[model samples]
Target: MRELFGEVIHTYTRAQALADGSLIDVTETAAEAGFRLPVAVTRTVWLRYCEWPEELGTGQSTEGRLWDVLWLAVWAARTAAEPSARITYTLGVVPVDDPEGDPVDVRLWAAITGEGAGGAPVVTIGAPEDW
Candidate 1:
């Protein structure tokens, strides 16, 4: 993590690895940024994601579905353990670069472990496609 203008930023390599399924443990990285729990980190991300383009559903509300996804991610994170815990979720159909074209689905992948110093929990988050 790099501190710029008093804000913590994840390096491009770290961000790419997170999305590409390479760098899975984020304990030390998040700790350095002042985040302690996977849910806390995920919630912060979800809130930011909510600011993006609207994703209208066919028979349901997109916001409702997103909340459900957020809930599941948090629940999964709470139970995450070292060596095997993973949190995977799909954001259904979302607006893509072209709003006039068909929307695409967004997927998030994460893992948690206890390999951090002092057995601190580690969390990693990534999306398969741009949101």
Candidate 2:
């Protein structure tokens, strides 16, 4: 249970980081790898990495970048991408707090396979009013 909770926190943190450009530079990184569109965020971030012979280096796997992978996952959230689809992040139970500094602002992010098979990345941005 604790492990799951920890993962949730990581998701929320990563999402905000990507959104704010404070995390790994997804745009520049992808561009350096020769991606035409590079990276973008439309309700969610989108990124695709490749380390082919012509780009980066030969036979190198452009993988393991956390934010990059998360962006791809979010892009794949569409039902059409189900062949390799996934749910990376989402706004969970946004409990209306008094707009303070400790409210419950839930944001879930995970590789959802089916119903109830999601992760919670709560991004609490206000006060906890629902005590």
Candidate 3:
């Protein structure tokens, strides 16, 4: 609290992060994938799993990859025995450069933020370190 920390010097908010590209809004796509609340992903997660470079010459599409991530996240959230603000799950992503190679298992975490858009809770998917 401000009382404990004294006067606030600076603050970096979620809105700033979203505006600066640190967080990528995926609410629209997530809604299509069956999410009721807002959703976002860290830039690291987006680049690692969802961003499909055209130079890769692979059949992977960004839309499809994003859907896969959200779908898996939804399943993890729904199957959780206890209600929690955070959920961790693993998703296998084939490397863009090595599409034929074995899929790499990436651990991801989705957390509900206390204050998000319109002062509502929002889901943020990111690598464990990012949490």
lDDT of each: 0.48, 0.33, 0.88
lDDT of model 2, residue 30: 43
Clashing pairs in 1: none
User: Which structure is stronger by lDDT: 1 or 3?
Assistant: 3
> What are the per-residue Cα lDDT tens digits for candidate 1 across 12-61?
44345445644433344344444466422343344333324446324444
Task: Kindly report which residue pairs in candidate 3 clash with one another.
Answer: none
Q: Which candidate should be chosen as best, given lDDT against the real structure?
A: 3
Order of candidate numbers by lDDT, starting with the best: 3, 1, 2
**Candidate 2 or 1, higher lDDT:** 1
In what order do the candidates fall by TM-score, top score first?
3, 1, 2
- Model 2, 6-76: lDDT tens per residue? 54454434456545743333445544543333343222212222212223332233353333344433443
Score residue 120 of candidate 2 by CA lDDT.
31
How does model 1 score by TM-score? Answer: 0.37
RMSD of 2: 18.4
Candidate 1 vs candidate 2: the TM-score winner is 1
